[model samples]
Target: MSHSSSDDEDTDISESEISEYEDKKYGELRNGVQNVKTSNENGTFICPYCPRKRKQDYLYKELLQHASGVGQSSSKKRKARDKANHLALVKYLEKDLMDVDVPAKDSKPTDESDPSVNSHEQFVWPWIGIVVNIPTRRTVDGRCFGESGSRLRDEYRSRGFNPVRVNGLWNHRGHSGTALVEFSKDWQGLQNALEFERAYELDHHGKKDWFANSEQKSGLYGWVARADDYKMNNIYGEHLQTMGDVQTISELIEEEARRQDKLVSNLTNIIEVKNQHLKEIEMRCHETTHKMDLVMMEKDKLVEAYNAATKKIQSTAMDMLKKISIDHEKLKLELESQKNELELRKIELENREAHNESERNRLEQEIRENAMKNTSLHMATLEHKKADENVMKLAEDQRRQKEQLHAKILHLQKQLDMKQELELEIQRLKGSLNVLKYMENDDDGADVLKKVDSLQKDLRDKEESLEDLGELNQTLITKERLSNDELQEARQALINGVKKLSSLGNIRLKRMGELDTRPFFEAIKKRHKQKEVEDRVLEMCSLWEEHLTNPDWHPFKVIMAEGKEKEIIDDDDEKLKKLKKEWGEGPYKAVVQALLEINEYNPSGRYVTTIVWNYKEGRRATLKEGVQLLLNQWKKMKKVSS
Candidate 1:
């Protein structure tokens, strides 16, 4: 239902009139609703007076329609519920009316009655009064109110409405507060107030101790109202006046002229002061410029002097560097020559050692062979002596046995001859007995038998004696052969002993003829001593090189402290002292001193290669070159000392 402009105006007037009439009629409704206990259920409409507890889940507009009997039955039961619901609705409406400050009913509706009045005049200035319930009771400073007002003002301003004024009031407890904000003439204040009220209700619902019971609200609550002259005066002070009280144009013009006269007079005075100040600044600037010119001239002179001094220093440094480089090269060459000689000496030593080792092995082999030959000779001599003793014993036994055999042979020969004669006599007696056999028979036969028996016995004795003689002869011959063999063995053993002795004598002669190595050993000892000296010299040269090349090397100065020289343990220190004494403290002395200091301070030489040479600055010598230079310096020192 869109209305024409006139109709809209009429409707607005009617709505305003009704609202005013209702506010006046139910001025005590807010108090009535304060005693009514409403349900806290959000978005739910219920009739407190109805016996049947019926709740309608509806929006506020729909709930209003339902309570007003729209689309509802007209039955007696329905009518009774409707009547009870209407009574509850009336209280809520009254509470809503009390939230806003409506115009009095007796006030004239000028814009609605007189159409000749401007439409803008019909619009109301939207003034909102908000109640912010603070959570604490602490003392509120003025800043708190100021911050709150500023926020509210900013909010209105952001919405394209210029807030005329924003004011705040704090309660004694500082636990609650109120803010009154007035915006430029518009009905938007009403909507803003309504939204604030809803937010306040939602934020504080079910929160304990948020409000003075549920009758009072918490958080932010706002209501719209017109700002009258008294309210405006209270908010903006007495400096603000209504449009009707504005001065006439003639009076305004006269006042503006007077203000302009004062402003022009003040501007003229400011101009005069500014001109005077400018003149003083100009004079100071002139003096500062003049001083700056003098300073520049002095700076030029100083720069020229500095450049000349730098050039002189650079030339001197270059010449010193060149001299050092030359010395370094010479030293390097000398060191190289010495190194080559040392290498040659080392090779010679190795060769001599090899020769000595071979000679020692040969001597040891000869000694071993001689010892073996001597051992064999000793064994042969023992064998020879044993053989000779055996031979002598055999000869003595042979002689004794020969004598015994001769005696036994003679005795046997005598017994054999006697037996032969007895046999002859028995034969003769047997012949006579045979002739007289007949005459003397028995006696004679017995005598003959006896004689024959004695002869047989004697023949057996002779045979036994002959057998003994033959056996003795065979034994004597065997003994003589054994003695002869033993004698030959002794002779052969003696011959072998003689040969061993001859060979041993030759070995001894050869040992005596071996070359003497005493002079070779002495030469080796001398070479070792020379090597030690070379090593020391090499070390000194290296130290001197480091001193020349390394910037971090700080030379030790031989200071006469307490009227005596400090004792240093460094070998370089001794060498440096000698050099300085001989040279009488020149560049050589400085170099020596630096070398000594480096050796004394950093024995490990860990920072030897850390120095970086800058080519742009000058021709800096390399480590090798510097080392050569140091060697030359050392050689000169040695020569001078010698």
Candidate 2:
């Protein structure tokens, strides 16, 4: 429930409660009490709430409101307002200067017309009236004026004149008063007063007559004049000049007054014009300052924008550089990969080139051998031809011999020529055989021997390679056993990991079985009833919770408060237990538990056992339906009782 505004009037209440209590405390005190105090005996002095001395703050506020009302006629009301302000200022200054004292000194000839002159021209306006509070009565020796007004009047009298009116201390009790005095008709009187008072001391009886003292104990104490121009009329025609020159003096005085009035008017106009110029200057200064501020703000914004753009550009450049670096790295890796591939290709090419070179060398040797064999065969053919030619020559020689035998007488002569031809033919056949032997030995035979030696070395190298392969196979067989053992251990570890996971799952299942219960759903049903179903569900839940938490309290007690035990017919204990068990194995056990905890219990009908026994065992037949049915009956009873 919210508090009323009246509460705020109680000062004991905090600020936050003020809003609630605003309306009740309209014009009342903070204590919620109305004021009954009346005004003063004189209506002009009436100050309500005066008995409460702590009303200074409120009084100031009321004074401000009063001043606002008198604004249009401010010149007329100004005197009253000034009185009030002066009274306040006097009181404040009195308090501030409680221990302070003014010392006395003689006056000095200091020009009051000079604005910047540091003479008696500067009086603390707020504290001026305090000097009037001084005690100066009982006609102190050598005094020409009475009490408080004496100090002011005598100072002016020294200047050969009197003030229109002056503030004074009338009695020894420091009572404030004012007095009017007349000045001489001649200007000399006024001039003398103006000059001499510039050097007169405050205390008429006891003091040096100079105004040059710096400390409070040795300084002139008279305040400067405060009378307005119109008041000066009161000081005329009473002293100094005679009645015979009155007319002429009046004329001259009038003319001089007119001239002073004209000068004042011109000064007023000039001041007005200057004031207007000052206002314009101030306005221009403000506008220039505002424009400069705007320009500076714009410059700052531009700088920020430039910085943001530069940052974005830098970020983009960094991103591009990153991309380029990645691409460069990728290209470098690809180049390295290609280079390695080329190197492998070159090695493969070199292997192929070496194989080709070996094949070419073998082919070249075969071609050389074939050439040598051909040369030998050609030489043999030449030798054979030579032998055939010899054989022919021999046959021819035989024929010649036979012919010679037939012509025995001619043979002796031809024998020498035949021998020479046969010898030439034999020499040619021998040369041919020697050339064939030289060709076989130098070409075919040497190449066959070199090839045989190379064949033998290659056969030895092949046998060594086969032996090395056999040892490598043995080493591979040993490594295979170690690898198989490692594989078997890894498989065993994987199986163990699987078993642990299965065990953890089984443990989790068992723990869930212990935690889940039936009360969970009752809470869920209660919330659903509040939101969308019916409020009866919540009522039922409340009743159920009472029965569940307080095992000793039964629903029958709440429903049958008149001790009507016979009306209690419902019981669902076994069903409740079955529901509880079902909740344990369900995946939503936490949610169900939360629900049941929220809505603990609600009775509906009779025990299932009672109904079954009545129907199956042929027992007494009176039985309620279930928890819900019992709830309906109890509700009906409640309505009837109501």
Candidate 3:
């Protein structure tokens, strides 16, 4: 709870009235009271809990005084609700500015603690008034406003103001129209000098009447401001901290005087605002009084109008009452006559109703008898119709079945004739085919299955025999000795290629050399002469020399026994690995070297063209086929856990 208005007023704060303030407490200052926000529009410390008001600009000490005074107030003051808030404010200031001590409200502390009554007010015994807009020119002497101080004093005296000192200061370099009039400690001259402000608005112009050139229509050419808008001078307009005081005797005194004068001027402005507000309220009150008088006059006229209307209504009502009485008597006579006629009509209606009821009962009895006869007749006709429909439906069903049976017999006969024709065609084809001539009768699809099984079994046997024969040839070739020189050269080349391949890790690749099985196998199988194989390979190398280096030509791929990718398998490399296992590494290396040279010579085969070939089927190998081979190998691996 706090007192929050546009400003901190000089009036007493009660607990109830202060509690009505906005919820801005010290704890809810800028960020939080813990970190006090000590800035206001004037770049000075402020009370966050108070809605800022003019003349409330405080030096840190003054604000501390306000907080501590309210926070530690006695019970009679009834400022209890704001005790915690003011206490927080004190803490906020202490924690931030590190100042000490606060004076009680309306009480005087030592001159040092109270900056208003500090050295300036105690030492400086003169009241200053600033006057402007005096006549001065470059032609005039350097004297203040080109006039002597005594002459200026004489002018102000004639105007009802006396000053102890009058000094004119330079505006720039030449004489200025401004002078500082210092009055004695007595209030007489000070009050008169201030009257320039009261009589007419005095400002920088310093003229009673302001003018376009001389400045007409302003009090003392607008210089009537009390010591430059000061009425009763107090503290300076801002904190003494901003005055650049060095705590020296003269500077401190001056700082204190400026601050005191500022306070006085601020307080005067506050009073003026309040006075203006009071005047406005009075004006509003007067307007309201006048409006009330108008309303009272209108009320009198409305009362007179109402009385006239009442008399007119009374006369019209009396005439209406007489007419109503005459009509009432006439209506009573007509009513009595009508009642006699109505009794006769009622007797006549009762006799007619009794006759009609008897006639209605007789007609209803006839209707019931006729309805029973009609119901019996309807049921008999329905039964007859149902029996006739049943007979027709049964006859129709028999006719439909007879027609269906005849059509079925015709379809069966046609099927039998087609079967006979098919048998004749089969006999003719069987007679013409030599393979079917030995076939037996009573055969079904099982016989066809039997023939296919026999063929597959024979093919499997051939493949197994071929594999075995190849192994036998490899063993025989390995048993024979190789020419030492040729063998050494081939082995050396193979060693170099392997060394290069091993040096480049999996991440980097450089491929060389090729392996061909046909020439090598032919030498082993047909000639069993290593020399023939080597010599023929040499001829093949020279033959395809141009094709090997051509980039556009790719007849063979660079393959290895194993690769990092799952599907990257070379059939030739697989065969070479097998051959090494069989005929030994020496012979396999020789064959691979000879093929590599031949492949190098082939221009069209310069670019790698991979194949999954069985020499009879030298089709280029596809990624799909390689992937399938990898999948098959994966499926065949033993299900073993490591």
Predicted structure with the largest TM-score when compared to the true one: 2
lDDT of each: 0.45, 0.40, 0.48
Query: Residues 154-252, candidate 3, lDDT per residue (tens digit)?
Result: 876787776655766554455566556655433343355455434434344434344356524333352322222332232321111111122222453
Winner on lDDT between 2 and 3 is 3
TM-score of each: 0.15, 0.19, 0.18
Quickly count the clashes in candidate 1.
5
RMSD of each: 62.2, 47.6, 51.2
Report the Cα lDDT for candidate 2: 0.40
Candidate 3 minimal-lDDT segment of 10 residues: 237-246
For candidate 1, write residues 79-108 as lDDT tens digits. Answer: 332343354355354234222233233432
Comparing 1 and 3 by lDDT, which wins?
Answer: 3
lDDT of 1 at 389: 57
- Misplaced by over 4 Å in model 2 are 1-186, 189-247, 346-642
Candidate 1 deviant stretches above 4 angstroms:
1-251, 311-642
Clashes (N, CA, C under 3 Å) per candidate: 5, 34, 47
Better of 1 and 2 by TM-score: 2
